[model samples]
Target: MAYQVLARKYRPQRFSDVAGQEHVTRTLLNALAQGRIAHGYIFSGHRGIGKTTIARILAMALNCRTAIGTEQRPTPEPCGVCESCTEIRAGNAVDVIEIDAATNRGIDEIRELRDAARYSPARDRYKIYILDEAHQITDAAFNALLKTLEEPPDHVIFMMATTQPEDFPQTIRSRCQHFSFHAVRFEEILTQLRTIAVEEDVIAEDAALALLAEAGDGSMRDALSIMDQAIASAPLDNGKARLDAEQIRELMGSVPNTVFERLMEAISENQSAPVIEEINRLINAGNSPSQLARQFVRYLRNALMARIAGENSELLQISPDERARAARSAMLFSEEDLTRFLQVMLRTFDELNYRQEQRFHLELGLLKLVHLQRLLPVEELLSQLPAPTAGKGSLGGGPLPGTLPRLQAAPAPARPAAPAQSPARPAAPARTEAPIAEPTRPAFSPFEADRDRKITSEATTPAAASAAPPAPQALTPIETAARAAETRATEATRTTETRATEKMQPAAVVGVAEPIAEGALALAAEADTAPEAAAGGSLDLDRIREAICAALEREGHNTATALLDAGDWKQSNGAIEVTLAIKKTMLALTMNAEADKICRNTLKQLGVGEKLVFLPGEASSAAAAARPRAAASGSVQAAAMENPLVRQAQELFRAEVRTVLDLRDRK
Candidate 1:
């Protein structure tokens, strides 16, 4: 006899020998045990997942001669030793007729089958008609057999095996007992392959068997056939076939997933040059662009599954090694990124089918992965906008983005160095002190009414301001007299308790920006003494803006309140104006009619000026070269463009206004 392939040699001879179709097998066994065999049966599933095999086994189980005289078989499984079972297993059973419906699927064939079903078994207990690929039968042929099939003779059994059960007429299917089978799982197929390898004396690596099983794609026969081909080509060592993963991959012309793993790593690291170089190398090495993209799509799918269900889960059909590699690749990206990569590669694979330049398209797809990694949403970029200070995102508060608070906790003045022994610290790390300490000061927001609540006592002390000036500090008599009169007037206005407190004020106060620079201290001293060079003029105007914001909050104008409160305040020409530090493009949103109304009511009540004024903050001004004149679009878009807050928002987020909806008519 010619050497048989693994699929034929290992073909299941009994229902009990079948794998991954327990539902159909168990049902058939029970029916045979109870002597309740049906006249007609339909077995349907994937092409190689035991549809025809189970049909043949069921025939043997029904006609096995072990229980020829008995009412029911003790074991529904075929007795392989019996003549009837042996003949059926050998495919030469006299009573069993196997027809390839694909070749003879006309009404004439159906009529002949109908005539044949009328006869009894020649020798076995029952005659069986097995039609393989039954779906190939025409609708007319199915109709011709429908009557006989609805009531087949008791001594005959009709078994039809098909991959596509839907193609059979509803009449034919309704009359038969339909058993839908499922594809064998990865583990089951792998287990079966391992058993075959051991029995065949093939020394195969587990990874090689895994590769065959994955290639099988849920079909056991497909896996076994691949294994048969692999064994023939596997190099012989000590008269035993030796198989490895790389050998199997070479045979299949599939790139190892590790190659894709490396590609993904380069992509995650934004190494576009390396990514393109790798693709070019793979193409130069005789890897087909289409095949490479196909494998990449599979690799990406596995990575996506590994991302969702973890690397060790049953959800991934890959072997343990590939699963691990896929998981490592998945870890480099977020779940969304993995999903996006999968979608991109899937489209790339699709494009490879008809495109003339497969190499260029595949490289473009891989490059897209690196490009997608750099994409930032407008909202995210806006969130990353700098706060008050450079490299710091906070305005004396933690609402903004930055790691200053966490960094300050480590390098703060209170945290001593590990090897230090002295209580007094050196100024070696002094530069680190100025930046980390200033912005996170919680009480120093320029927006709040009590921003001066933690004023430095030494910087504001009248007595300290009046201390004797050195000879280097030139001062005319008029300047000296003016300073004296200023100090005296401040003293006269203060109570006795206030005067004594100023005399003893501490150098630093808690919650103030710590480690104030010497230059700032001198500047504050000058402002306090001379009262001539204060950068922000007097505090009274600042007080006026705060009062108006507070009034708006009380009036339930929270939007206006937050807006006005986040800005700087200045009074000029007897008019109080608030400079809101909102986003430049979104400046339009802040200047809506509603804002205008709130501003008018609040500033009017404060008696600052007739018209409420809004000044763009420094960030808003810096975003655009100058405020753009509103274009002549429709009123809604024109208004959106004209509103200072909306324009400020556009600039802040660095987003373009794609479409504007008119909600005036909408509820």
Candidate 2:
């Protein structure tokens, strides 16, 4: 006779022999021992989790003649040597009948079962029904069995086993006692496999067994099945099964971490040929694209774990050799880079299913892995770079001054050492002409100087005024005394002219501009004629805007349009409502307050009592109103030059390129 497969030969025969399901087994054993069994029991869990086997053991326990004869149905453990136990193990038990619910899912079949269930057990203490894949039963059959399940005969017991418990009707499920099982753990599966291997006198390395255990993924049956195949594929001598890790890997077509290490080394070194050659070699060795993708993902995961855990890597469940290889691979790639590679491999796996040629996908994925240094996200790539040569200005100007580049524990780019001292900022632009000379004659009398000093001292402390001296000039005692009466006028004109020049001049010139350089010019332009206005009134919107534009141009136009077109003047209740449009709500509030203060201060100088209301609107509206008046022509008129609605949408969304979605969803 041919040898029995390991799945069947090593199947769990007793409750204790089952792995990862002690809770379900212990409860059933207690019920059987105490004679508190329910009419129906439902066992549910993932595949290969001992659901069917538990159902069989329950059936045998119910019909055990030895226990019944001894009236010691007292012990929950079924004596496997008993006639009922032996028959059930052989799959030909009479009273303990196992039905494949998947095959016998018809209404008529269930009706026949219901009719037969009405009779007493034939030559047994109880009649046990084991329904496998019970969820696959037809709706009609489920309805027919529902009534019987709720009120079955005292001797009849129903055990339904299904991977999907939710598929059954709630009524049917409520009538049954539910038992949930969990997938076997890797360590538990490995321990069990080791025991079986030793018992069978199989010679195998622990590493080889570990690989089998991981592939099992909490499935004892699957692990045993793979082990059996490995044994058969091994070189046999004197009827003894023997195998090594290499042979197991070869048979399973699993490329070890060494392959991953090589690929990573090639990637780090920027060599594509090795990875390409390896891909071809793997293809020749019969590895499919999907399988390769899975292997790549596994390697990537190991690499990431190694990178995070570093030397303290006791947390990982990998072999020592694999851990060492992982450590090496981790040194070559960042966790983020590995994560990106894993993500791409997953996508490659999906693409493989749709690709007419799978090799192409696998090769492409491998090539991507080899060239990962170039494919990493910009942030991640920057993290891998060395502290940016201190203002050598990275290939793309590193993070702005005083700001550190974000890092993520990735390998930084290899670069030369930077100076200990930080690089200096560029010098300001050169002065075009010689400095202007101060007047030799006094501009004020001694009394005027004293009054001016008194006024400055009254507004602020004497120390502050002394620290910031006014323009230099010689003065007579009498002229200085007279200057005291005109101190307010002189100071007011000085402040006004200083502001005008600062606003209208470039930043480079603002620092050195003299008080008298443009004071006369500014005063002429702003001379007030309205009797209600102050004699020195100089407040104007055009002058302020021009000043601001000049001050900002020296820095850059980056925010010129945004600042200018971000405000609008609206007529509201006989007052000018200055509505500022800004993308950021906080910025809008800030600009509105600043504009109100500036307008009020300037208006006070102009002798205006009206309060300025700084409101806020969409920035796009301001942009529309600010556009230059265009000559209406054939295409220009048709194009609707600077429409307020479209400009509003563009500014609000910050998207210059408009699409149909933008037009259709305007608020």
Candidate 3:
């Protein structure tokens, strides 16, 4: 006999013989025994999953004539030895007609089949028609058979099998009892492969058989065919056919499990050199880069499933040894790291088809995995950082903690007074005098000693300011020193102004040009000494309110300042009770905490005793008091422009007032 492929030689003859399709088989068997056979039936599922096989079994049960007495009736289990059963299994039965819809899919073929359905069985009890790949039938053909299919003769049974049931029209599908077949499970395919290996007397390792089953991808027929090929290629050692993992790997052009294990180990250890070496070895061995990526993805998927579902999960399709290995490997990587590695490999697989340098992409992808597995999660790294400390000059203030304090300009050295010139002869010009030698000062000093001396002289001696200094006939070092001092003073003033503008707030800028006098510094020092005395002495309600508003404006709290400035203040029970308009209530509530701190600090600095209190009042009264009583719109604009707060805001924001509105007019 010619060599028959394992797929056809082991074709299922009875319902029980079909693997991984018990649902369809059980349903058909019950229908046969209960005498509930439908005139038309459709079996739909993926290829090689027993859709056509189950259809043939149903046909055998319908037409079998070997059943006698109690078995005479329609039997679920057909005896394959009977003449009718044997002929049907052999595809040579006269009564059971098998048609390939792909070849006979036109309207004419369907018409012929429809006409033939009217005839009784010639050799069997019932005429059975099996249409394979029925979805390939033309629309016209389906339309032609619609009526006949719905009302077939009593002795005829129509059985159709298709891999794609969606291609069949609803009218055709609704006329038949549809049964959907599922893909065979990994375990089921593996078990069947093992059985076939034993029956063929081929020596194969369990791991090799498992790989064959996985390569089949949930198809029993494909697994059996692969096994048959493996057996053919196996070399006989002492009359025992030898099949091992190495032979399987060579036949499939697949990387061995050891290579994947080494690669994963290198990644876990963050060793890029080993990973690259393994990839090069696989490439030199003729394994395609794209195929390597796909296989690695499969390995990662198995590892992930093993981690999440343990070794017992039905989703994992590896042998016990491989499963245990994956579980141990999974512990070396975090879930996040595993997920990232899988994503990279999958993306690399997709890019391989479009990329010209596929090997380079694969190398870079594996390198990325090696580096990524060594990274700690963000949460873990954050937990390792030192906690922030709390205090002034710590990260809890205006400036960031650890920043250097602002530098102060040193005072200029004192210079001796110039000697009095003789009045008898014409006095030498100021420029002819020798220049004074003064100690060097920092470049940031705002003023020179010469300017200060001149100012003091003018202040003390009114007559001396009116008399101009005499000009010298020849240039002298003394006069040159004075000129240089003036230039240096000007440059220093410019530098100080620039620094202040960059660092200080708008309110602070207002006083940038005003130098703090010795007397004022003395008063500030005193105030710092006795805050309570200062607060009690300056506790006037109006003064306290103004100080609070000024402090708020300095901090860029314009809205809060406006709200506080518009409030009506009254002193009662050692507290300043301020009533705000209804519209400002929400603003006050939002800024309560910040405002309280600012108010307390300002009162302490101003030596004010009164505590601040905020209250919401009727809009009518508050609005009447807050509104500017301007006689005309021009006056309102003038007042708004003249307001110090508005001027500061304009300077701070570099904005201009577009329009001004009168609150009274609004009412």
Local distance difference test, per candidate? Answer: 0.67, 0.63, 0.67
- Candidate 1 CA-lDDT value: 0.67
**Residue 584 lDDT (model 2):** 21
- What are the per-residue Cα lDDT tens digits for candidate 1 across 89-177? 88999899999999999999889888987888889888899999999999899889888988878888889999899898888888889
In order of listing, the candidates' clash counts read 26, 20, 10
Candidate 2 error regions (>4 Å):
68-74, 268-271, 302-320, 323-335, 369-667
RMSD (CA, Å), candidate 2 to true, equals: 20.1
TM-score of each: 0.59, 0.58, 0.59
Considering only N, C-alpha and C atoms within 3 Å, which residue pairs clash in candidate 3? Answer: 429-470, 429-471, 429-472, 434-477, 434-478, 435-477, 435-478, 534-607, 535-607, 535-608
Worst 10 residues of 1 by lDDT: 518-527
RMSD of each: 18.6, 20.1, 22.2
Angstrom error at residue 616, model 3? 25
- Per-residue lDDT of 375-465 in model 2, one digit per residue for the tens? 4255633453445232211113343222233221122211111111111332223342323333244443333333332222234777776
Sorted on TM-score, highest at the top, how do the candidates line up?
A: 3, 1, 2
Model 1 residue runs over 4 Å out of place are 68-74, 377-667
